[model samples]
Target: MRHFIAVSAIALAAGSAGAQEIAQADSDWYKAGQERIQAELAKTQNTNKARNVILFVADGNGVASNYMNRLYAGQMEGGMGDDYVQPQEAFPYLALVKTYNINAQTPDSAPTAGAMNTGVKQRFNLINLGENAIHGDCAKVSGNELTLFSELMTEAGKSVGAVTTARLTHATPAAVYAKTANRNWEDSVPEGCTAQADIATQMIDAMEAGTLDVALGGGARYFVPKGMGTPNGGTGHRPDDVNLIDRAKGLGIQFVHDKAGLDAAADNAPILGFWSDSHASYEADRPETEPSLADMTAKAIEALSTNENGFYLEIEAGRVDHANHATNAKRAMIDGKAFADAVALADEMTDDADTLIIVTADHEHAVAMNGYCGRGTPIDGLCFDVAKQGIEHSDELVLADDGKPFTVVGYLNGASSVMVKQDDGRFTAPDGRPEITQEQAQDLDYNQQVLIPKDSESHSGVDVALYAKGPWAHLFDGTIEQNVIFHVMNYATNAN
Candidate 1:
């Protein structure tokens, strides 16, 4: 077994900073530090009323996740990854957000996103319902339904939309409008809950009732019946035999299933689009036919900015969470980069003076950055020894007590256990950790080593960071409960 103290020693030894060998009076770092302070002092608070609000959620992107993303992105651009700054990191104001649900310390998606959509915390597995509502019980949903931020903005005559790299009815996106006792009720309800509308139907109902102006993402199976085939070469999953896609068509909503369709959509018409049968492809595996997260975000802004009363849109980089659960660090960081690209495009398209652009995460994961490697280290590769006197890394690898190299990024526990399975189907641990090569660890499909075995990675009980710009961004000064996100939006928009 590995000792925590040994791991800490490795990190401390490799990451220890040396005393300055050069004069600090004229160094660029010293001057730049002063310049940054002056820039901050020059910034005046913006008190203008928000005309548009774009809430960007990179699901499962906690502080650690964001740090890893920054390093990966910097290395990709030929820099010492540690010093690179993401677009959201340039935001004028920020706060640390507590993400625990009412019933769980290690939070899940449904309640965390619900806490941001509604100004209160609820039990685990519930979405946009009060704390009194019982999870999985439809009867308790009637009076306990919470009014969502999207709903209030819609009632104020503002255009509303939701865009994600996930199913439109997934928890993070669903929190935009749908109110249900259970987040799992997307296309089908339980036996006793058949009287209630599923999440997919609720999305359509919002569009039909003029509450949602645009809807985009994957999960086409939920819109049609079991016998109906989706454009993505999959059959539907709806148990009720009702085709919600056709229902949207009958209601005059323009439905699209590909990038070409999304690009050619009439600017004046409301749109309902799905890029795949299930969740959209991961950023690295995405095909030309599917629109990127940035593409969908641009289309959403184009459609929603037309309303004079303004708009509210929710965009999610949902695949980051999925990849983390699978313990795939490369895909997770790739998706994280794509998410940052979307945020950049959104910021560029809208004026920060009048549009409140918020970037946050619903929760954190159990991912860890280990072996305090040298600067410019390949984030997804095996950890290398720190440089003795130069800024660049050394050629030698950092071996553990077992004389085996480990990755810089790894999960505390995940599917990739140290144990191997025998022909008899029983799992067994080897005498020592396996030897890992740099090339093998750097491969796109490599899974980092794990200490504890689990079918999937779990969420961490940690705080996530929130970045904001535009109206009332300064209000996010100190640390806050997750629910304060909703109140900040409500204050910026002045929506009752």
Candidate 2:
């Protein structure tokens, strides 16, 4: 019995010693891993320490659009010389991201942007909240609560800013700060929600909370009082309502309305610049009514870069989607180029090795650049004029050969069949007659007003491309889920 007890004690001591050795080995492995990470982090130049993160969102932009833009900018038409190759060619880090909503195969800006901002998949038409949240009721949602901007700036002590060619309260921008199930809560109230918070309320709250350092873009009417003429000569917000400009002032926000005002504002001060009452005009159609996307981006970087703690700025070129929906190829391409120009500017301004810059799209459009429209010969056999062809504005009406009165393009589902037009004023279909204007083709007696084409263009379901530069850019190598973007940004910014 004594021998047996001694044997048992010996075995227990041996087991305890082995356990202690294993624990020590694990501790050593952990220390080694941490040291390796620290060494890697130390090798990065302080200039590349990422004092600022700039995310440029080209709304509805896709791989096709990027290729198209490259073609246009390079003037690479018909195997032309590569003299026009832009600097985007050298972008080494690229990834493809999935962009589907929880409820829809072809996602809209609401949920797609929500996924990008909140790092969570959400239902269609919802912004910044999970699928189960009651529309416009932030109280119902649980578990999925961390917003990239809120998490980075509030918890991680980074500054946050947003700039867009669309309204600042629009889906893409709102996803960063506002929490609502329905994205359309700006103009209409959602079911089961008591507080119908507009873009103005979100902006004010962000400003008052002292997290949002810069807010620039359109949506002037939401900020102004009623009876006052908006920046676009439209009636402003309701009279007797709280003035957002004053509210911004109370929160120590430096409000600016025009380009000069924006330029004059101190870089250190928080800025609220609203250039238009609604969305800024497309880059192709801007006629004193809007600021270019590039301009907004440059201004935003200048304003946000002054922070010592680093800043997170979101710049959105939002009108490309609108043009794509209208099926206006020229407008879409031009707007996309304008957005790209903004990215170029950002690349130049934030070239510091530590600044992380990401360029991507929320979704893609159904627009495709098919093969060559013109014949082989440039002069004689070329039946279509590439430059002069104007698209039929609507698909409802058709133009007569004599250019006298409008007729029907064709009939589809009891609606007039619409045809897309090229730049040379030639229609796509062989039987499609030339109309006086594209709008004439669109104006038809139908159930829905076919804006560009009779049925309207749709968004593509393909994954979109993501381009990255600066610190940790190598991390964006493989195709990834949409939510992984948050993790990348979280890691890049060193957000805990």
Candidate 3:
């Protein structure tokens, strides 16, 4: 409700840019844009070797997601949102990364992240392991285990850490250390796969071995005994009777389950922390005491930066993917904004000359920016024809062929596909999906009308953007396989 009020006020303050008079493309103001591009072209690359690498991932944040999120952020700051430039956009090098898995054109989190973390693409549902492993098969995972970028950096004696808004055992973060045949095997091994390790077990094993120094984020459920909650009141979903928190203590890791604990943990000790039973709360609805995406990042950096050997850290805003799956635009964009804020904090904490910061997505979702609603229009608003095709001053809704007005944002497929017409002629989807809005099409509850109806929105095979700054960032200038990110980081860290 606060978001609705705040964002609604933001929209009112800026109103819509449709009211502004048009300027010719060849006008004097256009020269400023031309000059800016020339200045960018004249800049030289920083080819220095990197001492540290920080990778920020906004899960399911494709080009459209990034653009719309930036636009919304601008509005929140009281400007025409389109005018806002994201920190990632300031990166000197940018490129597209193809996100296909070995088996599917459109992949899920496991395989795509497999590429970024392991330097090789693999079959869907497989974690940091290689394609030699078959999904859901334990016996096939033997020599198929892939070497992680974190493993390489750690073997080089550098500090390594991972932070995420998702469960630390979630595919994206787990790819840094966990190798499993099934991504869903976070809490327990399957009935037949008990001989193999779960994601949580692999993470603890890695931490105990001293390869992963700072581990922060959620998934407390997977570390404790089933039928029990942590002493801090978190549910324990681990099938085993062993309490890994105590085990972590035995291994000299300072385990924390809340914000105060997180802040109090000294940078000298190895840390294993989680503030939620599963994934951290959505940014739109996070608890005050739960560490933010930026807080986790800042703390992880503070701890790891202590290593004279430098550090490798991966911070993932994984809730963006969850939001999109439920077709919640407000939550997704808010998570993206949270991600940008984290990047801003990283920029504050590290210098570009020695630290390489990369922002990218593992894969995309079935979402896009659609309909022409004029510049400065609220990105989540209904399409309006206030100034299209020479109509200079008419406050009219842009009608579809069936005479029903559509929205600026749309989806390729999702649960919000059907609209039940309301009393005021607005529409609403049932169940609110992950969250809800009273009005359909543009409200936070609106699902951005999809063409296909399914349980949830699906992933897309389309390429995602990779933006970088700092040493060897120039290597990101060309279109690349998603796995190439690993190569670039390895080369930048000189860990290859």
**Top lDDT: which candidate number?**
1
Best candidate, TM-score-wise?
A: 1
Q: lDDT of each prediction vs. the true structure?
A: 0.90, 0.66, 0.83
Model 2: residue 101 alpha-carbon error in angstroms? 1.0
Q: Write the per-residue lDDT of candidate 1 for residues 1-496, one digit (tens) a residue.
A: 3698887666544421321333673677876865786678789888888999999999999999998899989999999789999999999999999999999999889999899889998789989999899989988888888888888998888999999999999999999888888899999778877436899999999998888899999999999899889877899999987999999999999999999999999867789999988899999999999999999999999999888889999999999999899888999999999999999999999998899999999999999998868877799898888999989888888888888889999898889878667688877775667788888887878888887788998989799999999998888878899999999999999923
Question: In model 3, which regions exceed 4 Å deviation?
Answer: 1-28, 192-195, 386-394, 419-442
Candidate 2 lDDT over residue span 157-208, tens digit each: 7778888888888888887777765676653344444544565676778878
Candidate 1: list runs displaced more than 4 Å: 1-23, 421-428
User: What does candidate 3's lDDT look like per residue over 1-496, in tens digits?
Assistant: 9989997666545523322434554566665665675668687888777889998889999888888799889979977687789889887889999999999999898888878887888899888777678889888878777788888888888989999999999988988888899999987877777546888888889898777899998888888898887754866888778888788889989988878889999997798888888889898788888889999999999999999888899999999999999988888999999999999999999988889999999888988876666655667776666674562323666667656767667788887776544688765655433322325555565567776777789989888899999989888977899999998998888832
* TM-score on alpha carbons, each prediction: 0.94, 0.73, 0.88
1 or 3, greater by lDDT: 1
Ranking of all candidate structures by their TM-score, best first: 1, 3, 2
Clashes of each: 0, 20, 1
